[model samples]
Target: MDKKDLRIVFMGTPDFAVASLRVLVENNYNVVGVITMPDKPSGRGHKIQHSAVKQYALEQNLPILQPEKLKNENFIEELKTLRADLQIVVAFRMLPEVIWDMPRLGTFNLHASLLPQYRGAAPINWAIINGEKETGATTFFLTHEIDTGKIIAQERIPIGESDNVGKIHDELMNMGAKLVQKTVDLLLEDKVDAIPQEQFFNNEADLKSAPKIFKETCRIDWNKPVEQIYNHIRGLSPYPVAWTELYTIGEEPIAAKIYSANKIQTEGQLPVGSISTDNKTYLQIACMGGAIEVKEIQLPGKKAMKIDELLRGYKFQEGSYFK
Candidate 1:
């Protein structure tokens, strides 16, 4: 079958998914339709905001469906009308069996981590938080269980020592885009050789899950090792950032979000969460074995700023610490 003749229905919602959809559309693959989340109110104004996928789909003049409920009979009927030969999912919510099984060639998803590991909603973040030196992307056919399907293709990339979630995210986004295109071509030519997830690991206990991160998940535990704390901060950096409560001798605890920090090996002993600073150019938080020198941070109702800039205007009380 020619590339232009294959009818593809693309499903995604965030910026991560846009790269794959854009690659397909720009390369002239037949994207028959796009399915994204419904527009909803955002920000203080409560103005309706279209998802990133929806915005791009509009720019390309592609057909779009923003269903409130995927299993609604009306929505299913509408989806069936698309006559999709295949469907591609990226950074989207889980679909019902009816929806995933609707297409002829079946649905495939672009997962951020190398499969059989980090299988869940937030793979990229968890991989970094666990201090893995390597991670990658995977394309797999959808199945009954989430992220348990047979893999179609896998691409590996190294995680740099200082790479944050935002950096790794963009890298995988572009790499996954090419992988999507490659998967489509392989499927079109009937040359795909998919492998089951079970083949990659022996014991189920060896597998690590990337469960959805919550507000509490981003909280920094100052008692942990400095290396662990550093990884935690970078893993959630630039969004849903790792945070802590700054405590002074006789005032309310102030909440602060840490965006960037470096682990420091020191000989000076201090209790975990103790504050160490020059009150002008640096702010360091003591942890097990060492400390973390905060590089970028944000306070409530204030923009993110470098440590020096923040310290210039804001004074850390003499006995201030973090918890």
Candidate 2:
């Protein structure tokens, strides 16, 4: 079958998913329709906002469906009208079996990690937090369990020593887009040789999960080793960001978000979370075995700033520390 004749129904929500959808549309693939989340209010104004996928679908003049419930009978009837030969999901919500099983060519998902590792909602973030030197993207068939389906194809990439989640997220987004197209071509030619998830791992215990990150998950524990603290900060950088409470000698604890930091090895022992600053250029927090020299930070109601810029106007109290 020619690529232009295959009727595809694409599903996705965020910017990460846009790359793949854009590739299919730009390459003249027959994307018959798009399904995205319902429009919702956002920001202080409470203005309703369309999802990234919805906005892009509008621009391309593609048919769209925003179902409040995937299993709604009306929605299912509408989806069936699209007459999709295949379905593609990227960074979208899980679908009911009825929806995934409806298409003739079956549904496939573009996941950010190389399965069967990091199988969950936040794979890119967890890989960096765990200090892994390598990670990648995968395309797989959808099944009953989340992210447990047979893999169609995978592409690997190295994680740089100082790479943050935001950096890795973009790299995989583009790479995953190409992989999606490749998977589609394989499907078109009837040449796909999918492998089960179990074939990649020796035991189930060796698998690592990438559960959804919460506010508490981004909290920095000062008692851990400097390397760990450093990784934690970078892994969540530019997003939910690692945070701590700054306690001065007699002042109330102030909350601060740490965006960038570097590990500093030292000799003498200091109280965990102890603050060391020159009152002009640098701010360092003591942790196990060393200190973390904060490079970028943000206080409540303030824009993110470099350490020197923050220190120039605000001074840390003599006995200030973080907890």
Candidate 3:
């Protein structure tokens, strides 16, 4: 079958999914329709906001569907009318069997992590939080199980010691775009040999899960080793950032989000959560083994700024600490 002859229905909602859809459209693939989340009220104004995929699909002049209820008979009928031969999912919600099973060639998803590991909603965040030295993107056939279907292609990416979630996300977004195209190409030529994720593991205990991260999960624990704490900060940097409570003797505790930090690597340490700053360019917090040098931070009601800039406007008095 010609690559351009395969009618594809692409399902995605976020910017991550837009990359793959863009690649398919740019390559002149036959993407018959796009399905994204319904627009929702956002921000203080509560204005309706279209999903990233929806916005991009509009620019590309692709047909779009934003079904609030996937099981609605009307939605099912509309989807069937598209007459898609194949379906592609990326960063989208789970599909009922009725929808996934409708396509003749079946549905495939592009996941952020290697299969059998990080097989959940937030793979990129957990991989960085766990301090893994490497991770990758995978394209797989979707079945009854989520992220556990047969794999078609994968591309590995190295995680730098200082790399944050944002950096890794961008890298994988581009890599996933190419891999999605490759998966489609292989399917067109009938060259794909799907591999089950079970073949990679002998026991379930060996797998590392990528569960959803909540706000509590992003709180910084001062008792952990300096390296772990450093990893925690970077892993969540620039979004749902790692945070700590700054307590002053006479004032309410302030929530401070830490964005950029590094381990000081000292042999001796003060009490955990101890704060030492020159009132100029640096803020160091003591931990179990050493301390972390906080370079960028944001206090409540303030934008994220460098330690020096924050120092000029705000002061951490003597004996103040982060709890």
lDDT of 2 by residue, 39-137 (tens): 999999999999999999999999999999999999999999999999999999999999999999899999999899999999999999999999999
lDDT of 2: 0.95
Better of 1 and 3 by lDDT: 1
lDDT of 1 by residue, 154-253 (tens): 9999999999999999999999999999999999999999999999999999999999999999999998989899999999988779999989988989
> How close to the true structure is residue 137 of candidate 3, measured as C-alpha lDDT?
98
Backbone atom clashes (below 3 Å) for every candidate: 0, 0, 0
Residue 132, model 1: lDDT of 94
Scanning candidate 3 in windows of ten residues, the lowest lDDT window is 260-269
Superposed on all Cα atoms, model 1 deviates from the true structure by an RMSD in Å of: 0.7
lDDT (Cα, tens digit) per residue for candidate 3, span 45-107: 999999999999999999999999999999999999999999999999999999999999999
Per-model TM-score versus the true fold = 0.99, 0.99, 0.99
